[model samples]
Every structure is written in C-alpha cells, then in structure tokens.
Target chain A: MRFDVTILGSSSATPIYNRNPTAQALNINERFYLIDCGEGTQQQMLRYDIKSSRIDYIFISHLHGDHYLGLVGLLSSLNLNGRKKPITLFGPAHLKDIIQMHFEYSETTIQFDLEFRATDPSKSEIILDNQDITVETILLDHRIACTGFLFRQKRRLRKIIKERVEELQVPVEYYAVLKRGVDYFATNGQVYPNNELTTAAEEPRAYAYCSDTLYNESYFEQIAGVNLLYHEATFAHDMLDRANETHHTTALQAGEIAKITGAKKLLIGHFSARYKTLTDLLDEARSVFPETELAIEGKTFVIES
Target chain B: MRFDVTILGSSSATPIYNRNPTAQALNINERFYLIDCGEGTQQQMLRYDIKSSRIDYIFISHLHGDHYLGLVGLLSSLNLNGRKKPITLFGPAHLKDIIQMHFEYSETTIQFDLEFRATDPSKSEIILDNQDITVETILLDHRIACTGFLFRQKRRLRKIIKERVEELQVPVEYYAVLKRGVDYFATNGQVYPNNELTTAAEEPRAYAYCSDTLYNESYFEQIAGVNLLYHEATFAHDMLDRANETHHTTALQAGEIAKITGAKKLLIGHFSARYKTLTDLLDEARSVFPETELAIEGKTFVIES
Candidate 1:
C-alpha cells in the first residue's frame, strides 16, 4: 500500500509570488486526507491533479486564515460537484460555526454529510481509528487553538506460509486463525506452531504534521518515533526573534523538534514570504537534523518504516 | 485620468481549469475599486500585478460564495501588509457579522478600518458619492439579495485658457470662478464671456457591473448610456432554460440588456465551468450587440466618454 504526502501549498500567512498558503494532501493506502487547507487549496489540488473525491477526511491545524481559509470553498465546490460521500472534518470547536455561517448567509444547502470532530488544543486526543490507520491530535503551542495530527498505520496480520499450511493439510477455515498467530489444532489432534506456519508482517509506519505553532516541547513525546514529520519552518534561524514574536517556528527550531522527536525524516514548509529563496532555511534545518528536506509543492514524500 | 478595468477573475460559481471566479479591479483616476471578489482574487490580483493597497472601495454584489468568498482573506492580507488606510466596503447587512465572527474566532485584530455600508438589494440606492465618483446600487434579479454597481465619474471643472486669461488680464483669484463657468469681470468694467475664457470639460464616464443575476430591466434607466457594461453571461443562448432556472443570465440575454440600455460597449463574463471555450457564448453576445467583448482575465478595458 502507498503511504505518501503531496505538498499543495507551502507559503506562510499570505500567498505571494506564486507560492500558495499552507495545505497538504496525505495519501495513506489510497485514502486521502487534507491538512491545513489555506486559500487556493482547491486550485492547488487541481494543478497537482489530486482528486478531491478521494479525500475522506480533512484536518485543520488552526483557525488562522493561512491554515483553514480554503476549507469552506473546498466544501462548497465538493457539494457543487455532486459529492455524496460523508466527509469527516477535524478542527477547533469554532470551525463548525464558521462553516455553518458561510452556508447560512449564502443560502447553500450542502449535498453531503459533514461529520465534524472538534479537537482540544490542550491535550492529545484520538480523533479517528479505522482499519487502515489511527489518527491522533497532538496539542501545539500557538496564538490560538492549534493542534497537530499523527497518523499511524494499523498493524498488519502475519502472512501465512501457503506451502507449509498446505503440506500440513491445515483446513481452509483455520487459515485466518493461523494468520492471526494462533496455533492450528488439526481434526486429528495434531498441533502446529504459529511461527512455523506464518511469517512476520511489515512494521507499521507513522507520519505527523505540525504547523503554525511556536517552538514548544509539549507535544514532543506524543509524536516521538514518527517515520515522517512535517513541521512549519516559517522563518530562518536569523529571524528567530520574529518567529517567537509571531508564535511561529523557525527553521532551526523545526529541526530541533525533529531531532527531539526522533523522527526519521523532517519535511519543513510554511516558508515566510520574505525569503525569496529557501536554501538558507533548508541549510539551517539540515545543520541540526541531517535528514531534513524542504517541502516543495507538488512533490510527494513517502514514509517508510 | 485613467478609467480602466482589469479582469482579475472571470469564471463563475467555482474556480476551475485555471480560470478564476468573478473579480474585477476598476482603476478610476488611479484609485482602485474591487467588484465581486471571488475565491483566489488576491492571487489573481498578484498574477495581474494589480496592487491591493490601491483598492479603497470594495463592492460585493451578493452573499454568494463566488461573489464574496475572497473578501475576508483579502482584508486580512491587507491588514497583514501593515495597511492603515481605511477601506470602504459595500455589501449585505450580514457581511459585517460574518467578518466580525471570523475575527473573533481567529482572535485577529485588523490594522485598518473597515467601514461597511449595508446595501438594500430591494431598491436602488446611492451607496457612495465622493469627489471623484458616484456609486449607485442597482437592484438585480437573483435567488438571493443581490445588487449591481453603477459607477459614474464626477463631472470635471472646465479648463481655463491661461494665455487667453493673461491677454484678457483676468485676476488670479478669478481663475477658480472662471473654471466654474462664471463670466470674468475686469477692472475696466468689461465682462468676458465664460465660453471664451475656458473650454468645456470632458463628459463624465460611467461603468456598470452586474453578476449572478437574471434577465431584468428594472435598472435599465439607471445604467443607461454607460460607457462600459459588464454583465454575467453564465450560459449560452442554448442554455437559456438553465440560466433562467439558476437566476443567471445567458450571453444573448446579457447582450440584449446592453443593447436596450444603450451602453457604448458590453463585456460579458462569469462563464460557467461547462464552457471549456467561450467562443460560442461570445459569438452569441456579439450577434445581439455588435459592440460586445469577452471579459478575458488579465485584460484591461479602457472606458472613454
């Protein structure tokens, strides 16, 4: 199964010089999840050829305009396009009011079910769990209510050795139990060890997205050991003062977070518009975390275990 | 003085296929007036190189998402850029509530003043009358409370003939009165005719913008003889039934309105996503009104009297 993230937009606050605001598309085993849909996210999706219908869940990190401004428009467009599947939205408590107010004033009746789950910014909460993955919200430090999301793939069952099972004459009904690591007891009172019948499955992988937050270590333990980490690097190390004043993370700070969380790879984005080039920020990040990479738009980053 | 309009966005309803939604920037003597800022309008402005700081007045035709969805983002971006100049907003009464609700939830403090004028969609009203122009709202036929905007340039003063005035020995103090069409009286008790002292000023120009509306003639007299008229043509003549059902205008209907109102030129836009190419709609409009033109994005149309 494919597990990758596509960058839709990377600009911070304002979309300037052709760089769009914060938005990313995460594909976990073909199901899509959108994170931080800023303005022009729909267009960005179109530009990148990402189908909106595949997106079943949307996670908004904060109420900031750069983080969630594109949500209403995206929802409206989905309704217009005759989307009927229910969509799960995870965000702050006030997001429901904002979306409802827009629909009320415009007299627009949404054509699909919108399931909303409000996230608490003060604690780590499990927002969703499915057969494919489990999603948890990690509280982050920001000017307003903001939280990051952690996606961990579900553990797969052990793969049964078909040759060993057939040679041992294991019944078809007992195949599923064998895959679950249970010993097989034949009708003739013969016992078969699970380890001899099956092999271990691949390890589950995890990815975390952190954006529009200050350099705080509150959520470090929650997202520790993530395979892939996307953190907002809105400023360079030289502009650390501005980053603190605005409650945003600098490139160096983002690198430190990756190092502390023991993330295998760090993907940094939410670049400030002042930096026409991002080499300085990337270098600053790499100085701390050698596995850091810039989150370039339209590029997909795969998470590996 | 410059009297031109730059088409920032021309698509209707939702943005699609690289064509943006409805948005236009009118430059009247270097002052910018924004009409119907749809989604991605600020980015459109940047793409067309239209400065947002010059926009002092914004007129929203209705509460439809395609017409006003970009307003909050644009306003927030302006504030973020340290804009301190007050901007006048003309829209529905509920717009202030929506904007305030967003600010309250986001905890954002605007750096500039946003003066709002509630427009009554049921009747024609004079929304603004400044020294440079007079803005009047024209009631439109739509599913929601919608209105069109009519912008008329304020009459200019007659130009004074400096050489004629010097030869005629007119006092410097009388120059102002002479430009107001008053006869100049010299110290010798001889009256110089106002016609000979100065030339008549150019006729005032007018432009009208109508979007998300149906075929209606209620504002015919109000927008008659406008130099430039931009009407929404969301459908072609063949799709007249759909246009009527959606309370939108067809290309032929829009052209008929321009012709009936005696507008010097007609610009048709707000094209539906169904139209991959606008040749059919443009041909239909041109067949009705010979002076019709398509409202192409990034193209500027000059209005002359």
Candidate 2:
C-alpha cells in the first residue's frame, strides 16, 4: 500500500511571491484526499500534475480564507469537467452553506453527489471510516472553530507463502481463512499450522495533519506515535509573542509538539510571508525534533510501514 | 489621463495551462478598478505588478465562480495588509450576504469598510460616478444575472496653453476659470477669447467590458463608438452552438458586436480550454472586425483618446 502527502501551498495567512497559502494532497493507497484548499490550490495541483478527478474526499480545517478559499473554485472546476462521482467534504458546519450559496447564485447544478459532514471543533471524534482506513477529528486551539485530521490505515491480512500453499495443495477458497491465521485441516486428517503457512501482516501506518492552531497538548494523546505528522509553523520562536496572540504555533512550538507526540517524522509548513527564507524556522524545529523537514511546495513525503 | 486594461486571467470557465480564469485590472487616471476576479487573480496581480492597494472599486459581472471566486481571497489579503481605505464592490445582491457569511464564520472583523452596491442585471444604470469617470452597467444575456461595465471618462477641463497664458499675463487666481473654456476678463476690462487661451480637451475616452455573455445586441446602443471594447469569445464559429447553449459568445459574434458598436479596438478574451491555439479565433474575429485583438494574459491595452 502506498501512502504519501504532497505539499500544494505552504504560505500562511496570505499568499505572497512564489509561496501559496496552506493546501495539501494526501494519497492513501490510490485514493486522493485534499486537505485545506487555500487560494490557488487548483493551480498548484495543475502545476504539480496531480489529477483533481482522483480526489474523492476534501477536509477543511476551518473557515479562514487562507484555509478554504480555493474550495469553491475547485468544486466548480470539477463540475465543469463533468465529474459524476460522489465527493465527501468534511469541515465546519457553515462550509456547506457557503458552497451551496455560490452554486445557487451561479445557477450551477453540480453533476456529482456532494456529501457534507460537519465536524465538532470542540471534541475529538471519528469522522469517517471505510475498509481501507479510519479518520478522526482532533479539536485544535484556534481563534475560530478548527480541527485537525488523523488517518489510520486498517490492519491487513497476513501474506500467504505461495510455494508452501501449492506444495500442501490447499484449496483456493481457503486462502482467505488461511490468511486470517486459521490452521487448515485436510480431508486426510493432516493439520497444517498457520504460522508455517503465512507471515505476519505489516503494521498499519498513521498520518496526522494540524494547522492554524496554537501550541496545546490536549490532542497530543490522539496523535501520539503517528508515523508522519504535519504541523503548521507559521512563525519562528523569535515571534513567539505574535504567534501566541494570533493563536498560531511557532516553529519551536511545533517541534516540541512533535517531540511530545513521539512522531516518527515531522513536516513543518505554513510559513509566514514575512520570512523570505525559512532556514531559521527549519533549524528551530530540527533543534527540538531531529526528524523534521520543511514542507516545500510540490514535494511528496511517503510513509513507510 | 491614463486609461488602460491589464489582462490578469483570460480562460473562460476553467483555468488551464498558462491561462487562468477571467480577471482584469482597469486603470483610469491612476485609480484602479478590478473587474471579474477569478481564481489565482492575486497571484496574477503580483505577476503583473498591479498594486492591490490601489484598487478601490471592484465590479463583478455575475455570480459564476470564474468571475468572483477570487474576490474573497483578495479582500482578505487587503485586510491582512492593514488596508484602511474603504472598498466599494458592485455585484448581485447575494454577493454581499455571501461575503458577510464567510467573514462571520471566520470571526474576522474587517478593518475597513466593504460597501456593496447591488446591480440589477435587468436594467442599465449608472453604478458609479466621480470627478474622474462614470461607470454604467450594461445588462448582458447569460445563464444568470450578468452585467457588463461601460467606463466613460468625465468631460475634461480644457488644457490651458501655458505659454499663451504667461504671454497674456493672466492672473494666477483666474487660471482655474480659464481652463473651463471661459473667456478671461482682465481687471482693466480687456477680454481674451477662450479659444486663444486654451485648447479643447481631448475627447473623453470610453471603454466597455462584456464578459461571459451571449451574443445580444440590446446593449449596443449604450456602448456605441467606445474607444476600446472587451467581449468574451469563448468559442469559434464552429462551436457556435456550444457557445449559444452555454450563453457565451463565439468569436464571430464578438467580432460582429465590435463592428456594430463602432468600437475603435476590440479585445476578445475568455477563451475556451478547447482551443490550444487561439490563432483561428483571432482570425475569425478579424475577418468581421479589423481592429480586433486577443486579450493575452499579462498584456495591457491602452484606450487612446
């Protein structure tokens, strides 16, 4: 199974110069999920050759312009392209109304089923579940209603030893049962041990995304031991006062969060436009969490299980 | 007086390749007016070096995502930049409610006044007037409420012949009145004719912008003999049926509009993504109207008086 995160836009608050606002694409297996569509996100996708049609789910953290301003445009483009597959959107309660109002004014009847699921920003809850993975919402500390997302892949069945199965002449129909660790009993009264026939399944991987929030430990337990974690580092530690006032996390604080959560790797982004170069912010985060990387636009980070 | 239009984005419905959706910046005597801000408009403005702070008025043609999806992001950027000057926006009635709702949900209290003037798409009316110019709405035929804008520079005061005024020894205090084509009366009772003191002001220039509209001749009378005209040419004559079905204009129809309106120059934009090369569309328009030009992104068209 392939799981990866692609950076679309990383600038915070305002898009300036080459850096765009916050937006990312998470590829789970073959399914694409969009996170926080800021302005110019569609353009970013186009620039990076990410197929918009592959996206089946969109997760928005809040109602801030820099967070979800590009959502309407992306939806409109999808409709114009004649998309018919249903798309599930998870966000604040007001997002549905806002998207609907624009469509109503434009007299555009979307050609796809748009399902909206409102998330409670004040509590942690499982928002989505399927055979492949489960998604939970983590309440974030921001000025307005906001929530982060934690994606956990489901445990897979054990891999069968193809040569051993063939030598034992096991029936094809029993492969599913065999993978589930059931010992096979032959019609001749011979027993085949499950451990000898199969190897253990790979451990499920987990990824977490946190943005536009202050440094708070309330949600740390939910995201602890995540294989990959993406957190907003809008400012350096030197601007800690401003970050606190704005309810935004500094790079140092983001590093501390990663360290506390025991994340395997930390991706830091949402850089302020004021910082032309992000070397200082990256260094600050690496000082606390050694496994830190900057979320450069168009770069993809793959998670290994 | 400087009167020019800068093409920000030129694609019709969906942004593709190097072309974005519809967005333009119209500069009239240094005052900037943004018209039809599509997605990625702020980036386009930066690419063209059009100062967002200089834009005091915004005119939206309709409620289509390609026309107004970028407005909120632009407004938010301005607020984040600490803009204090009030911005007047002219659009459909629902636009105000939509903008207000987003702000409310984000808990953002804008630092500047955002005045909204609702324009009735069914009527032709003067929407804005000041010492510099007058803007009138031209009802356009489209799927939803759509209107074009006709900008006419206000009648200018005659430019005084400085050398002649100095030779006549006209009093400094009387120069203001002399520029108004009034005959100068000396304190000694000597009269100087207005023609000798000043030359007639350059003919007031006019520029009309019609976008995302069908081929309708109803508004031609209001825009006759305009110095410059920008009309949507979403398709060529071959796709005329598609253009009609979508309530958009073909290149041939746009050219006919330019010819009938007696516009000095015609700028055809809002190109469909179907056409990888617009040479054929340009030729089609030029065959009907010789003074036709393509509205290439990042290009500026000056309206000569």
Candidate 3:
C-alpha cells in the first residue's frame, strides 16, 4: 500500500512569507485525493507535479476562502484541459451554490460531471467506502462548520511464505488455498500446518487529516491509533487564549492531541503568518510528542505499516 | 509624471509552462491599478513586491475565469491584512454578485468600503475621471460581454525655462500666469512672450489595454495614437480560423490593430498554452508592426511622455 501525503500549502488565514494557504495531496495506492484547496493550489499542483486530472476525489474542510478559493480555478482549468473523467467533490452544501454561481456568471457549462456530496459536520459517519479503504468524517469544533477525515485501509488476507511453500513442495494450484489459512496436503499423505508455512499480513495502514479546529477531545477516540496524523497548529502555545477565541488549536495542543490519540507520527502545519521561524512552534509540539515534524510545503510524508 | 505598465501574467486560457494567466499592474503617478487579476494574481503581487494596500483601483475586463478569478482572493487578502483604505472595482455587473456571494458564504463583513461600478459593454463611457487621468471603456467583440480600457492622461501645465525666465527679468508672481500660456508683463514696459519664456509641456501620455477580443475596427478611433498599446495575441497567425471561432485575436491581427490605430508602441501577450517560446509569435507580429514587444511577466514598460 503506497500511502503518502504531500503538503501543498502551510499558511493559515493569509498566505504570506512564501507560505501558501491550506492545501494537501494524499496519494493512496497511486490515487490522489486533494484536501482543502487554497488560492494557489493549481500552481502548487503544477509545481509538485500532481496532475489535476488524476485527482478523483476532493474534500473541502469548510467554507473559509483560504480553504476553497482555488477550487473554481482548478475546475475551470480541468475543463479547459479537457478532463473527461468525473470528479467527486465533498464539502458543505453552500459550496455547491458557490460553484454554480461561478459557472453561471462565466456563462460556461461544465464539460465533465462534477458530483457534489455534502459532508455532515455535526456528526461522525462513513462518507466514503471503497475496496481500498473506508473514509469517515470526524466532527470538529471550529468557528464555522468543519469536519476532519479518517482514512482507514482495509486489512488484507494472510500471506504465504514463499520459502516455506517451496520447501514443502507445495503445488502451484494450492497457493491460493495456503494464503487463505488452509492446511496443505502432501503426496506422502502428510499435512503441513498453515501457521508454520505462512505468516500474518502487516497491519492495515491508516491516516487521519484534521484540518482546522480548536482543541477538543470528543472525536479523539475515533482517530485513535492512527499510523499518521496531520493537525493544524495555527498559533504557538503562548497564544492559547487567542486560539481559543478564534476556535483554532495551538502547537502545544496539536502535540497533546497526537499524544492522546496515540498517533505514531505527527505532522503539524497551518502556522499563523505572525511567525517567520517555526523553531519555537516545532519545539513546543516536540516537547510533548517525540515523533513530531513540521509539515513543510511540497514535502512528502509516508505512512509505515 | 510617472506612468508604466507591469505585466504580471501573460498566458491565455490556461496557466502552464511557468506562465500565468492574464493580469497586469498599471502604475500611474505612484498609484497602482490592477488590471485583470487572474488565478494567482495575489501571489504574483507578493512575488513582485506590489503591495495590496496600495491598489485602490481594480479593473476587470470580463467575467471569464481566467480574467477575474483572482479578484475574490485578492480582496480577501486585502481585508485580512487590515486594509483601511477603500477600493473601487469596475467590471461586469455580475462580478459584484460573485464578490457578495463569497463574502456571504465566508461570513465576513468587509472592513473597507468596496464600491463596485458596473461597466456597460454596449458603448464607450468614461468610467473614472480623476485629476491624473480618465479611464474609458472600449467595447470589444467577444463571446461574452467584454470591454477593454483606454487610459488618457490629463494635460499638465507648461514648463518654464529657468534660464530664460531669469534672463528676461520675469517676476516670480508672473510664473503662474506664464505657465497658463499668457505673456509676462514687465514693470519696465517690456513684455516676454509665453512661447519664448516657457515651452509647451510634453504631450499627455495615453495607454490602451485590449483584453481578449477578436479583430474589429469599431473601437480603434477611441484608442488612436496611444503611447502604449497592450493587446491580446492568443494564437499565432496560422491559427486564424481557430482564433476567429473563439473570438480571440491572432498575433498578426494584433499587430495590424496597433498599426492602424497609430499606436506608438505595441505589447502583445496572452499567448496560447501551445506556445512555449514566443519567438515565432513575436516575429509574426513584428512583420506587420515594427514597434512590437512581448508582454514579458514581471517587466515594466514605461509610456513615453
């Protein structure tokens, strides 16, 4: 399972100091899913070689301009470049109206099918279920309605050890049965136990993306034990009052969230424009959680099984 | 008087090959007027050190996504940066609705006074009249209701020759009258002619910005004898048929327009994505008009006085 994420933009409300607004690309099994496209997402996508046509799913966190302003331009470019495949968009209900108004004012009828699925921000539910994974929405506490996404990969069946199978002289036709945890029968009327010949598959890899919200423990258990966690640390720990007033989390709180959720690895981004150097913020997060890293733009972070 | 136009983006329809879509900044006497903000205009402004707070005037040519998609994002950024100065926006009437919808969905009240003046694409009208210059709409032929802009500089007072004034024993009080094209009267019963004492001021400079449009002679007379003319050359001469179908102008046609309009200099841009190096397009346009230049991004062209 090739599960990795690339940070597109790392700024919070304003894109300053060479930092862009919030946006990211999650590649799951060679499929790209855009998360929270900001104003310059299309250019960033081009900069990072993330093909817009390859993105079949887009998840918008909320209605803030920094989160979804680049959507219309990306869609227009996709149409201009002659995108034939359908693209599904998941966001709040008002986002659909915004898209419609842009198309209406521009006097353009979209050439591709743009399916809109409204995400429920008030409760947690399974929004997407496919053969590879099940995506569930995690309710978030924010100034506006927002939701985080938990991508849980499906567990695969047991794997057969190739050396053991060859040593036992197992027939090629019985390889499938061996992987299904069945005992292999030998020509000498002896049985080879499946547990001795095969090994259990690696644990399913999972990733959680938490966009923007204040510190809250309500949805922590749903994302517990995630292999990789991305959380927004819009401000430093000293600005906790300001973060509380604006319904945003601080770097200290982001680390606390990772600690409470038992996230194996933590990536913190969405830094406020007030600070040019993020050394203090990173140290604040690392003070509590050891496996913490800054979500630098255009850097890819992989999830290990 | 200082007047120059800087190209921010030059690509047409799509932003590719490290080229951006349509956008430019006109500096008139130190005041910045943003013209046709494309998708990444805000970032471009930031890259080139064009402060958003200094942009009090914005002119959007049409409602096409490539032409005005960056307007909302720019406005939001200005607001976020605590812009107390008011701004005047001129574009198609529906553009106001788009801005309103974006603000409404974001649940934000604009801190500055955003005044939107609708442009009438059917006829030529003076939309802005200030002491420095006058901006008029030039009706264009396009699929949508599109209009170009004609910036005409107001004539300044005559300049007095310091040596001539001193030699003629002209009184300091008579300097103002002499600049008004009147002869200076000496207390000793001598008269100094205005032409000999003060030479006529330099010719008022004018610039014409022709956005996406097909070749037409209807608005040529209005932009006649412009000091600098910026026209869209979306495709090469070989794509004439396609240009006509799309209501866009070719490089040859743009050169022809500049020649017939008696423009002092021509700057051709808005190149199609098919073109990587614009040498061929530049040569094609230069074949017809000798004083032709490419609207290279981040370069400023001064209008000679």
Candidate 4:
C-alpha cells in the first residue's frame, strides 16, 4: 500500500518568501485526498505534477482564506475540464454556502455532483469510512471553528503461501477462507492448517493533520500513536507569547505535542511569513523531538508501517 | 501624470503554460486602480513589485471566477496588513454579497471601510469620479451582465509659466485662481493675461478596458478616439465560431473594433489557454490594426497623451 503526503504549500496566512499558504495532498493506496486547499493550490498542484482529476476527497480544516480560498477556482477548473465523477468535500457547513454563491453569480451549474459533508468541531467522530481506511475528525481549539483529521489504514489480510496451498491441493474457493485464518478441509477429511499456509500482515498505520490551532490536549488522545503527525508551527519558541495571543502554536509546542502524543514522526509547517530563514525553528523542534522534519513544499513524506 | 497599466495576468479562464488568469493594475497619477483581480493576483502584484497598499480602488468587469475571485483574498490581506484607508469596489451588485459572505464565515471584521459601488449594465454611466479622472461604464454584450470601463483623465489644470508668474510678482493667494485660466488683476491697475502666464496643458487622454465581452457596436462610439484600448482576444480567427459561442472576441474582431473606434494604440490580451505561443493571435490583430501589442504579464503600457 502507498501512503504518503505531499506538501503543496506551507506558509501560514500570507504567501511570502516564495512559500504558498496551507495545502497538502495525501495519497492512500492511490486514492488522492486534498487537504486544506489554499490560494494558488491549483497552480502548486500543476507545478508538482499532481493530477487534480484524481483527487476524490477534499478536506478543509477551517474557513480561513488561506485554508479554503482556492476551492472555488479549483472546482471551476474541474467543471471546465468536464469532470463527471462526483467528489465529496468535508468542511464546515458555511463553506458550501461560499462555494455556491460564486457559482450562482457566474450562472454556472456544475456538471459533476459536489457533495458536502459538514464536520463537527465540538466532538471527535468518524467522518469517512471505506474498505481501505477510516477518517475521524479531531476537535481543535482555534480562533475560528476548526477541526483536524486522522486517517487510519485498515490492517492488511494475511499473505497466502502459494507453494504450500498448491502442495496441499487447496481449492481456489478455499484460498480466501484460508487467508482469513481458517483451516481448509478436504473432501476426504484431510485438513490443511491455516498457520502453515499464511503469515501475519503489517499492522494498521495512521496519519494526523493539525493546523492553525492553539496548544490544546482535548483531542490529543484521538491522534495518539499515529505514524506521522503534521502540526502547524506558526512561530518559534521566542514568539510563544504571540502564538498564544493569535491562537497559534509554536515550534516547541508542536514538538512537545508530537512527543506527548507518541507519534512516530513529526512534520511541522504553516510557517509564518515573518521568518525568512527557518533553521532556528527546525532546530527548536528537533531539540524536543528528534524525529521532527520540516514540511517543505513539493516534498513527499511516506508513512511506514 | 503616471497613467500606465500593468498586466498582472492575461490567460483566459484557466491559467496554463505559466500564463495567469485575467488581472490588471492601472496607475493614474500615482493612484493605483486594480482591474479584474484573478487568482494569484496579489502574488503577481508582489512579483511585479506593485504595492498593494497603493491600490485605492478596484474594478471588476464581471463575476466570472477568472475576473474577480481574487478580490476577497486581496481585501483580507489588506486588512491583515493593517490598512485603514477606505477602498471602494465597483462591480455588480451581487459581488458585495459574495464578498461579505466569506468574511462572515471567517468571522473577521475588516479594519478598513469597504465601499461597494454597483455598476449598471443596462446603460453607460460614470461609476467613479475623482480629481484626476472620471470612470464610465460601457454596457457590453456578453453571456452575463458585464461592463467595460472607460477612464478619462480630467483636463489637467493650466500650467503656470514659472518665470512669467515670478516676473509679474503674482501673489501666492492668486496661484490657484490663475491656474483656472482667468486673467489676474493687480491692485496697481495692472492686468496679467492668462495666456501669457500659462501654456495649454496636453489634451485629456482616455483609456478603455474591454474584457470578457463579445465584439459589439453599441459601445464603440463611447470609446472613440481613446489613446489606448485594451480588448480581450480570447481566440484566433480560425476559432471565431468558438469565440462567438462563448461570447468572447477573437483577435481579428478585436483589431476591427479598435480600428473602427479610432484608438491610437491597441493592447490585446485574455488569450485562450490552448495556444502556448501568442504570436499568431498578435499577428492576426496586427494585420488589421498595426498599432496592436500583446498585453504581456509584468509589462507596463503607458497611456500617453
């Protein structure tokens, strides 16, 4: 299974220092999920060679311009490109109103079905579920109503030993049952043990995205033990006071959250436009969590299971 | 008088081949007026070194995403940067609803007063009047309610011949009145003629911005004899049928309009994304009107007298 995330943009509210606003692309087994599309996100996707047509789900963390302003433009282009397949959008209820008002003024009816599922910011609950993965919303503390997302891949089925199954003359229909940890019984009452023909699969892995939020522990348990955790570090340790005032998190606070949550790795981004150089911010994060990495735009990070 | 236009974006509906969507920045006597702010406009303004803070007014020809989607983002940034001076926006009446809806969702109170002046699409009217110029709306023929803008520089105040005014020992209190082209009478019964004290200022120049509209004869007389004309040429002559179907103008038709209107210079843009190179479109326009020039991004065109 391919589980990786590409940072399309990492700048906070303002686009400066050649860094765009907050946007990311998550690929789970070839299913593309766009998260928090900011301004210029379509151009960034084009620059990074990410096919916008493949994105089936879009997750918006908040209603801030930097988080969801590119949505309408992207949707317009998708319609222009003759996209017929329906796409699901997860965000606050008001986001649908904003998108609809523009289309109404333009007098354009979208050719594809645009389904909006509102996310609740007051509680953590399952928002999406499929055969491959399940997504849950993590209530966040921000100036505006915001929520994070947690993606957890389902555990893989047991691997079948082809030679053992063939040698035992197991029927093709029994293969699926064997993989489910059941013994195969022959017509003559000869049994093929499941343990001898199968091996355990890799454990389920999870990824979490938390952005534009203050340091709060209410939803920390929901994202505990994630393989990868992406958190916004809008400022460094020196600007902790400013971060608190603005309902943002510092690099040190992000690192501490990752460590306390037992995340395997930490990805920090949503950098403020004030810092032209990010070395000190990265170093500050690494001081607390050595597994920290900067979520640089156009770079992809894989989740290992 | 610093009457020049900077092409911030020029590509039609979709931004492709490194070409951006439609956006323009017009500078009239150091007062910047942004016209048709598309996506990535602020970034384009930053790339071209155009100061956003200097933009006092914004004009939108229509509600298509390519023409006005960037307005809210730009307004938000202005508020974030602590802009206090009021800025007026001239567009359709519903444009105000679209802008206000987004701000409401984000729960942001714009620090600056945002004034919306609705433009009437049924007839021509002066939408904006100031000391330097008067802006008139040109009722356009398009699929939607759209209007072009005609900027006429108010006739400049008569220049005071510096040496003549000093030689006559004209009192400072009479300078403003003298520039109004009136004869000055001295207490010693001396008469100072206005012609001897001032030379005729250059004739007032006009610039017309016609975009996202079909070639129509109704507004031709309104923009007759303009110094510079910017018209949308969305397609080449070969694609005239497509242009007509989409209610857009082809390069050949744009040139014909400019020639019939007697514009001194023609600037053609709003190119279709299908053409990676714009030479053929430029050549097509130049074939009919030799004064045609491509409205290249980041390039400034002077509306000279």
- The estimated TM-scores of all candidates read 0.96, 0.97, 0.96, 0.95
Model 4's alpha-carbon lDDT is 0.92
- Comparison by lDDT, 2 against 4, better one: 2
Lowest lDDT 10-residue stretch of candidate 3 chain B: B12-21
Global Cα lDDT for candidate 2 = 0.93
Which scores better on DockQ, 3 or 4?
Answer: 3
The clash count of every prediction, one per candidate, is: 0, 0, 0, 0
lDDT for each residue of candidate 3 in A147-239, tens digit (9 for 90 to 100)? 989998888778888898888888899988887889888999999898888898778988898978999999899989999999999999999
lDDT of 4 at A266: 97
Interface RMSD of each: 0.9, 0.8, 1.1, 1.0
The residue-by-residue lDDT of candidate 2 on B1-305, one tens digit each, is: 89999999999888887889999999998999999999889989988899999999999999999898999999999999999999999999999988998888888889999899999977899999998999999999998889999999999999889999898799888888888889998789989899999998889999999987889889999999999999999999999889889999999888999999899999999999888999999999999998999999999999986
Q: Kindly list the per-residue Cα lDDT of model 2 for residues A1-305, writing each as its tens digit.
A: 88999999999988888899899999998999999999989989989999999999999999999999999999999999999999999999999999988888888899999999999977889999988899999889999989999999999998999999999899999999999999989889999899889998889999999998999989999999999999999999999999999999999999999999999999999999899999999999999998999999999999765
Pairs that clash in candidate 4:
none
Can you give the DockQ of every candidate in the order shown? Answer: 0.70, 0.80, 0.67, 0.65
Q: Residues A1-305, candidate 1: write the lDDT tens digits.
A: 68999999999988887789999999998999999899889989988999998899999999988888889989998998899999999999999999999999999999999999999887797899998899999888888889999999999999999999889888899888888899988788878789999998888999999888899888899889999999999999888889999999999999999999899999999998898899999999999999999999999999988
Top-down lDDT ranking: 2, 4, 1, 3
Every prediction's TM-score for the first chain? 0.96, 0.97, 0.94, 0.97
Deviation of model 2 at A3, angstroms: 0.5
lDDT of each prediction vs. the true structure? 0.91, 0.93, 0.91, 0.92
Q: B204 in model 3: Cα distance from truth in Å? A: 1.0
What is the alpha-carbon RMSD of candidate 1 to the true structure?
Answer: 1.8
Which ranges of candidate 2 are over 4 A from the true structure? A184-193, B184-192
